[model samples]
Target: MSYSEAREMFADWGVDTEAALDKLAGIAISVHCWQGDDVRGFETRAGASGGGIQATGNHPGRARTPDELRADLEFAYGMIPGRHRLNLHAFYLDTDETPDRDEIELGHFTPWIDWATAQGIGLDFNPTFFAHPKADDNLTLSHPDQGIRDFWIEHGRRCREIADGMAAAQGGEVVNNIWVPDGSKDNPVDRMGARRRLEASLDAILSPDYPRERVLDAVESKLFGIGVEAMTVGSHEFYLGYAIRKGAALCLDMGHFHPTENVADKLSAVALSVPDILLHVSRPMRWDSDHVILLDDSIRAMAQEVIFAELTDRVRIGLDFFDATISRTAAWVIGVRNMQKALLEALLSPQAQLKQAEAALDFTTRMILTEEIKGLPHAAVWDEFCARQDRPTGLALQSRLEGYQASVASRG
Candidate 1:
């Protein structure tokens, strides 16, 4: 069906396609930098990735250097509609001087700030808490040793400062998300002690007050990892309470929760307590596998909740998946576009009509309309969006992907 005809059909349901498209254009999905290089940051002292993070394929065109990653990102951004931000890690710092995690400074990341400024995009940040000798035991921030905890605390502090620097350079606020790999594979005798140390370490790390407008602190939690199956110190309940007490943004990673749990339902519950939320939009096959996002029911439900709860302003959407089996750049484009598609579908929903029916106890109308809206010509509106954004749609998008992959086939 043509976009005009689809528009008329949506209008019959009291939905405005134009407004939906406009809103979709404004939402920026923070594309992760790790996907370009399969999470291998350019740290001189970089260690093997552990803590349940594994990017399993050896795609031919894995970005080898900072320049290559940035170039790949530029190419991916071209195909993706709307101006989005880049979520950077502290370990991705590009500089001549080799610096450890704790010693990293703003100068090391100045190139990224310049690049983001040039691209007319904003920056978000994360402290790399895994893949180091200190984290080899799967303990950081919550380590029993005071000195060890201090080391990770310093790293977290520096990351927040770097985030502040990024915000100052880009003239916007930067979300600095902290996720630790502190858990035990076997059942621990003293979970309380570890959690106490974690809380204290976090307090120390957040001691230095960065401007709220420039730096927003967020804490992420996990259920389990490959090694840490017995217990995860930074579980959902721990971070939820901490965020409420600290007035920090709570990060809800789609892949971090249990398989049976619905992240969409947690939005409203957490929204009531936390000041802001940072979402790590990822797809989990059976575990926290970090698969590339698809336009699936989970994504649609999450997007719908964001719209239904009127939590757009309070939520920051960011992608967090690294699938090395495919073209990395293609992975970025596909995942981001699917996120946009989900949001667009949510925007095009006849929410007012459905809500009105539910309020009036018209269960029959609500259920019928909800199911019927699924058959709407969403693809036609999506195609129109891509056309207006100068992005290829349908077969053209696939052709572009093939061409880009072939162009980068010689990467060694």
Candidate 2:
């Protein structure tokens, strides 16, 4: 279908316009947009002795009023609803002051848990305590804040304390999505000990204290620069395979693997290694790591080929993307669209033809790709969205999308 016609049909289905664009390309996404300090109202505060509304002397940091926080939560829900989920990354709090356990509970973290419970929105908890850049001399699991061993131990202790406590008190589960940003120079000789340190860290975090059933150690991969930082778990199959052997499942980030990595193959490998697995969906761009864009037509086609080849009911899709300005709600919409498109594309392909081609792979030594020209029924849902793209369809999808993106300083 043409873009405009496809967009029109998508609007009719009640899908957000941006979401339609994302889905057309293929993928499932859960948008990560922080409710920044600005919107939370970090301006002046009531002074001591009731003097007046004066700024705090020491920059008390921005605090979201209950109303503001609630509104943002509602706004996010309205956009993505269910299917797409939200992950509370440590960075989003927008604070350098390490939050105490209680403050962490009170801030967006607690409210988010409460909100998710009420809204039935799935929430993933990321407990990444140590920063990796400082480990320049040697591959260390320790944070600069604490001794290498001490930091690793303390982080696991805290994670267990928080996770166990919440799982018992809260009704829903919390996923301890672990993505350690660690590594050092590319010298294979010096890097020999890095994986061991990483495994040690995971061993502590994934212990019985943490809810293994609910927790997902999403070993995120990063593009390691220089020689100090080793790339994330994305490139190291052995690291992830070991995690599977240790009883903790795998967490795959779509963007972590670059031009050379195949997401479908990664997914299949993880699935075969472990009984249960979780996934993070994002677009990988050659220009950068974590570009957080959609697949576009070509990538989408490739993703479809992958899913058709290896996807199983055991694997679950999560919308994981970083959007600075896009509202949480809009991000959710885009994610859902991407996921639906990916799956639909897979389901609609010529499976029989694909299977036949696979059989011939042994003799022909060529890859077979199944394709179809039929547009999905859901394409019609975008009519209202298309109408509103240039004008107003009584829904401010564009304005809201742009507004959220602007808030995060995200361009395109």
Candidate 3:
């Protein structure tokens, strides 16, 4: 179905039109170096090669021209319904200057930042290759060169600096997200160099050098294999738990775990160990590489929905992916809406009902305390909860799930 048709169908289902609109509006896309229209064969090719192998475009070829790039950003902005901001990755900036430690140099590309500001959206400066494997094993912040170490440390600091400057420039708060694409294969243990580097980076981030309260440093973890190429923070719990011990919060990427890992249980366990949290929402697939699938894929979406259905207000979901097609933008927008629908269904699940039944275990204990409870005025919470439901609600929820299943089948 077309995007508008899907919206209309959801509206017709007694779904609050305004809420659906807002949720769709709340959805934003992250532009990887290759996903836009300006670059030829961009979706397939690795991005422009200048500063590094996976570095941002430079010198303005026909595909990487300034005007074309701007147009692509505008196109992405227009696709998001209203008042929503984009989560920008920093791989697009030309790193020709390689600025000094304390310098406030805005690399070769300022127009992208300017454009995002004008659109009433906040941009995440210093975006990293957190999802890609190359940045994990091949890169390091605390290398021998002072310039590189300074650049890495300065990059973390500058995200806060740019956020303040951007907020002043655009009149709003900007978000700072950080993830190290670093770890070893055989020895997943963080060496002195890795720990010191991560500590230095986090210290710069959490420093009072800028108003630290104004920014958020989301430390994203990854999940990979057992080989030398396998390096991610997801399995390296000690390192991640240590970071949280030293004042950094975890950004739990949904795609970054094995099928056996219960995401809800993981969150509960991690929350006990760590005080703060940020969530990265994506569809998980069973593979060694990152598979950027839509959120409605049942095997992936079910676990996420089950966890989030009972969520309080603390969880914040950020959509992360390297869009491989023009249709990916609209697909993601619809995918988020579909995931919410599944979450609503999951909330109404019989298993959850059973858990609620189990919560009444305390009711028996309270009843044993006093026989006067029977005579006194008391309300039946479970009866009232059951009273609020009917055959229609059940059918409606079942129909929605079946509809989602049918939709996935058709796509396949």
Best of the candidates, TM-score: 1
The pairs that clash in candidate 3 are 136-181
Which candidate tops lDDT? 1
Task: For candidate 1, write residues 296-366 as lDDT tens digits.
Answer: 99999999999889999999999999998999999999999999999999999999999999999999999
Total clashes for model 2:
39
lDDT to native, each model: 0.92, 0.47, 0.45
Which regions of candidate 3 deviate over 4 angstroms?
1-34, 37-70, 76-82, 94-109, 129-137, 142-147, 185-193, 225-239, 272-276, 295-313, 323-355, 361-412
lDDT of 2 by residue, 181-284 (tens): 45444535534355666666667756654455555455554444333343432235745666567765566666555566666666555666675556666665
Q: After superposition, how far is residue 65 of candidate 1 from its true place, in Å?
A: 0.3
lDDT score, candidate 3: 0.45
Model 1 earns a TM-score of 0.98
Can you write out model 3's per-residue Cα lDDT over 303-361, one digit (the tens) per residue? Answer: 34434443333344455443333233333344443444434333322333334545777
Which has the better lDDT: candidate 1, or candidate 2?
1
TM-score of each: 0.98, 0.66, 0.60
What ranges in model 1 sit over 4 Å off? 46-49
